[model samples]
Target: MAEISQVSLGDAIYDRVCQDLVEGKLRPNEKVTIRGLAERLGTSSTPVRDAVQRLLRDEALIQRSMRDVRVPVLTEAQYLEIASIRRELEGFAAGRAAEMVGPKEVRRLKKIVERNEAAAVAGRWPQAVKYNQEFHFALVEAAEMPILLAILSGLWLRMGPLIAGYYAREQLGLVRHHQAIIAACENRDPAAAAAEMRADIDDAKEGIIRYIQSFTIDE
Candidate 1:
């Protein structure tokens, strides 16, 4: 029982840290220390260390020296590589979701889109980013492909910091490709839904790639 409790605590720590990464609260290349994290989380160091080890094994956090760990700063090439995979997998998920979507799911997704648009209009970048993540994950979840969703979650963990930076710099367009996706889903057109999903990812990739290139050139 105690062993199970400890494992649960470690998992809790891991999840909290991952949520920070997903929400862009953790920046790229930011240093992380087990003691510091434990302090911040108001817990003991054991669970924090366990969680950090898990992240290190997942390549979400890289160990530097004996006590140093940091988030990876992905290069432009790396980012594009991941984005390419996302285009394929995420598009497939959207296609599957099109077949599975019901009126309730459609309305749920529409609400998410509306919330995202409202956040963007209010110039609330963080809220926009949160809603955007919610929207994508919701679509993938509707597909009911657990393995695919797990893969996409890992991809998002790596991309979240970069995405936050991107939305911070650019204005959120009101008529995003999400509308097209919603329409396709409403019409029960799988191919069109997939195409729109791919297009949406490609559009974001282009902008993010440009941003990465400029940063690299500056460096």
Candidate 2:
């Protein structure tokens, strides 16, 4: 029982760190020390070390030297690659969701979308990011494809920080793509849903890529 409790605690630490990463509390290329994390989390170093090791293994954090661990700063090529893959996989998931979604699920997703828009419009970027993730996951979950959902989760875990950073700097637009996706799902149009999902991803991809490129030019 004691051992189980310790494992659970370690897992909890891991989850908290992951959530921080997803929320952009931990930025790309930011240094992370086990001791620092342990102190910040108010826990022993053991679990914090274990959690850092897990994130390292997952490629969410990269080991720079013998002692330096930092969040990964994705190159433009890498970001574009991931975005292309997401366009295909996530688009497919949206299509499947459109076919399977019921009125109740549609209502739930609509509420999430509305909340996300409201948060974005109000300049509550963190809340908007949270709602955006919720909206995407809700749609994917409706597809009832566990394998696809798992893949999407992994992708989001890697991309979430970047998305949060992008949205934090930019003002919220209409998010017409999201509304289009919802409408397509309501109409039971799988192709239209998939196309809208792809467009949404493409738009974000272009914006983030441009931002990164400009930063590079400035440097």
Candidate 3:
């Protein structure tokens, strides 16, 4: 089990909403209610409002006027745009971390990757997604660039659901992709790290597109 620190009320709300999005409990373009969110999170309306505001700023949620909100619909173009930004930002983060990643950090990342692999094999999709997120975040944090990390955080929020959906269908390939990233970091090869990161992001985009399209004909 990974050490997931308890977050503030707002962050807790945000993560729970994000998890719902990933699990398809909150579908694309579905309207969200503050009261509903508060009840679901077992928190008050204030933190739920704060969380929704933050997600709106991230463009993960659409805010209509002062009272209404909806899940941002995932369009092909929008998905591509977000995927491109993530590739550029995260690839840069991985490359930079390669420059500064020490033995301790590498060891931690390896452990996360290993745990993530095990989780995936055991069909624990949520745990796999959680570990995968921690692994990437650990690398980005190791870069030691607060501004860059902050920027990447927004991009990652948008990427979360697509990633979760992708892994819900495909597991072994995703696990292998993480292994490639771990290998690049272990070898301290920044260029390889960036290339692998981009490839992984691109693959994820394709997988998500395919997954959505498979269901579109029925809709």
Candidate 4:
């Protein structure tokens, strides 16, 4: 019983840590320690260590040394590759979600969108990023495509930190793609949803690739 409980705790910790990564709560290249995680989570070091190992395997956290780990910082080339993949996969998810969306799902997503818009308007970049992530994940989950969701989660694990770091304040005043997606879903229009989702990804990608090239890419 005790062994089972320990394993459950480790799994829980792993999921919690993954959520932080996927939601951009942990910034790019931020160092983290098992001891710090254990203390923050109010648990012992053992489970935190176990969870850290799994995250290391996932490449979400780079192993700096035997005692040091930090969130991985993606290169420009890597970011572009992932952005292309996200456009295809996430667009499909939105299309399927449109086919399945009901009043309840629409309400939930609208609430997340509202929070994201509010945060962006308030210049709370980190909070806005998290809510943006929440809205995307919720839309995907509504698609009922577990395999696609898993793949997207893995991609987001690597990409989230970069996004969190790169959300420009200037872009907040631009037209939001989420509102178009919601309109498509409310009408159960798969084609429109797919187009809107792809547009959203492309919109972010154009700015993000520029940001990466200007700041991080080598000539």
Total clashes for model 2: 0
C-alpha displacement of 2 in model 2, angstroms? 3.1
Q: RMSD per prediction, one decimal?
A: 2.4, 2.4, 5.9, 2.8
Off by over 4 Å in 4: 168-175, 210-219
lDDT of 2 by residue, 28-58 (tens): 6678999999999899998898999899998
TM-score of 2: 0.90
Q: Is candidate 3 or candidate 4 better by TM-score?
A: 4
| Candidates sorted on TM-score, descending | 2, 1, 4, 3
- In angstroms, how far off is 207's CA in candidate 1? 2.4
Stretches of candidate 3 off by over 4 Å are 1-31, 63-70, 214-219
With a 3 Å backbone cut-off (N, CA, C), the pairs that clash in candidate 2 are: none
Error at 147, model 1, angstroms: 1.7
Q: Write the per-residue lDDT of candidate 1 for residues 124-179, one digit (tens) a residue.
A: 98888888888889999998888998888899888887787777777656337788
What TM-score, to 2 decimals, does candidate 4 have? Answer: 0.89
1-219: candidate 3 lDDT, tens digit per residue: 122332376787888886566444565556799999888778778878888888788688887657678776577887888788888988998888877888888888888888887887788877787787777778888888889877766666666666665676676445566677767878888888888888878767666887656544211
Q: Per-residue CA lDDT of candidate 4, range 98-216, in tens? A: 99989999999998888888888888878888888888889999999889888999999998877877774334532278888999999989999999888888777766776555554
Cα-lDDT of candidate 4: 0.85
